[model samples]
Target: MPAVNSQPRRARSGNRRDEAARVAVLHAADDLLVEHGFGALTVEAIARRAGVAKQTIYRWWPSKVEILLDTLIEDTAKRLPVPTELPTASGIRAYLRDFADFLAADPAGKCLLTLLAEAQHDPGTAASFHERYLEPRRIAEIEMLTRATEAGEVSPVLGPEATMDALLGPIVYCALTGVAVPRDLVDTLAENILRPRA
Candidate 1:
């Protein structure tokens, strides 16, 4: 691993406080990303916004994109609920509907679409994003779908992974296109892809 000496090491007594500062920086970055979009955000801007040294931000994250990706994952995508109990047929529909609403309501949603587009032009960003964020979300959604299948809420013939893609693809597509996603479409996606067979 590479050394991280960009910032002076905090005393052991202050490690917890340092972590709090780091979180503050992340929060500032998240706000800047939502406010200005990625094109205008920078380490200096984030440091100023967070009231931290530039070196502190750099010590933790190598690039602005990395920080933005971290912020997005921490704030948005990971928070999406995959029910612990097997979701009922209606519960599953409600979950998807709620998810759509959440996505449409935040700049984090726009940030994700921006990241996806950036990934197309920047392979390193794409790889990091897939590993750090998207892959985990995919796995979690699949796991939730599996629970639904076991509960007889979803057809056994449709695998969880495929169902997840089929269900989420439209939302992603709309997000990318800046289109409004109707709640009705979200429910239809749940019924068409997740409903159990007769």
Candidate 2:
């Protein structure tokens, strides 16, 4: 399957005024999320910060959750882009290291963790998160893994879905538990995942 566009939907008219407002709102939401966190962020505060009316924000998004969702999408795309230039094993390792660092320090990481927590209570949020962010990334990774398998770089014992769960589950578990990710874990995962099954 082709990679999905994970960006939030926006007006397609290409009008400069609408574009400017959208940029301002996204930036404001990002700044507020980093400064005050999700628990403290508010739509009113975002409007005030962006110098736009609350109606302006509501025009594009239903609530602050949607705004944060958009910000998270943008940030993750820029922060954890898939590595296309390296060999598959190397690329996976590099991606894991980047993910570890993102969980440790990036504001986007905090946003994602917050969203995960919130999704537990909000079914709408859960569905949107899965459809808009997680699924697309999974599809992209699976595509990469398929290429590696075809090229004979790695012989995965499990199918693509299970293999991905095995590779990414540990890091995500560490993030959820607030445990520090071990420095060598990336290499260990790469070795195990890329090794041919006996």
| Lowest-sum lDDT 10-residue window in model 1 | 8-17
In model 2, the runs with Cα more than 4 Å from the true position are 1-17, 84-87, 196-198
Predictions in order: lDDT? 0.77, 0.82
Candidate 1, 51-111: lDDT as tens digits: 9988877777899888878778877645655666766667667767766766687666666
- Model 2 residue 189 lDDT score: 84
Candidate 2 residue-wise lDDT, 1-198, digit = tens: 999999988868642447777878888888888798778899999999988989878878998888888888998899888655534666676788898888778888878888888899999999999998889989988888888778777787788999988888898889978999998997888788767333
Which regions in candidate 1 have their CA more than 4 angstroms from the true location?
1-17, 77-79, 196-198
Q: Which lDDT value does model 1 have at 43?
A: 95
* Per-model TM values vs. the true structure: 0.84, 0.84
Clashing pairs in 2: none
Question: Which pairs clash in model 1?
Answer: none
